[model samples]
Target: MMISALPPGLPHPPQETERLKSAAEQLETSFLAQMLKSAGVGEMPEGFGGGIGEEQFASFLRREQAREMAQVGGIGLAQSLFEAMRERHDV
Candidate 1:
């Protein structure tokens, strides 16, 4: 099998916050934001997964937003922000 090389400075997965941030910035991708949205992953109430009765989910989002903001000096936008850093940097 032939090996395929990746682009310079682009790891399969980010290895640090700075790297991830830089990649997102350079590629105009919102990986961090998308990841943040995914981490709040949870199933909605039965029969309401795709229904209009997502009040509980909405409430959860609100609380999560407040917590994130408070943690990041009002700039924390998503749990993924912190989670990504922790994962990439092991910090």
Candidate 2:
């Protein structure tokens, strides 16, 4: 959530722009996490420490992984979202 300072004389984005960017990134993360979950990327194999607890917490791991992936430019969804919002808002 650390936004870099805009260069001097550049117009700063409104507060709503920051909120939109954050929301867009979060949406992308959620989408990616769900996709990873659907693909069973982190499911523990049977008899390999797999259990109800693991199952219960699998989504959490997937979410964290997805967040990292998004941060590292996974699928470019966040960038696309940000660009689209910027255009829509003329910011």
Candidate 3:
């Protein structure tokens, strides 16, 4: 006999629903962060810059900005992702 993790015909609990939503939002944030990084949104100046520490933390700034954007329903990608995932998993 095999033990199933989700089992059949059982809907996910509220925490699981929240997890799916969070996952979708995270994906959107990650995509936006990458785009911002590629666009040099946080790039330091050639001179008179914050130097190495700023370089290390620049990505964090982009990520937080991206998270804020996603929270504001950025590009509507997160909502679409959440719906698709919920439907696919029969949640």
Model 2 regions lying over 4 Å from their true place:
1-14
List TM-scores for all candidates, in order: 0.25, 0.72, 0.79
Candidate 1 achieves a global lDDT of: 0.47
* Number of the candidate with higher TM-score, 2 or 3: 3
RMSD (Cα, Å) of model 2? 6.0
Q: What is the lDDT of residue 15 in candidate 2?
A: 83
Identify the superior model by TM-score, candidate 1 or candidate 2. Answer: 2
Strongest candidate by TM-score: 3
Candidate 1 error regions (>4 Å): 1-52, 75-91
Per-residue lDDT for 21-41 in model 1, tens only?
A: 544342222333344456654
Cα error, residue 6 of model 2, in Å, equals 18
Pairs of residues clashing in candidate 1:
none
Relative to the true structure, candidate 3 reaches a TM of 0.79
Instruction: Name model 3 segments beyond 4 Å from true.
Output: 1-12
Please give the CA lDDT of all the candidate structures: 0.47, 0.81, 0.87
Please, what are the lDDT tens digits per residue for candidate 2 over residues 1-91? 6446555456556785787778788988999999999999889877797677888799899999999988788898988998786665553
- True-structure RMSD, every candidate: 10.7, 6.0, 3.6
Choose the strongest candidate by lDDT: 3
> Deviation in angstroms for 28 in model 1?
32
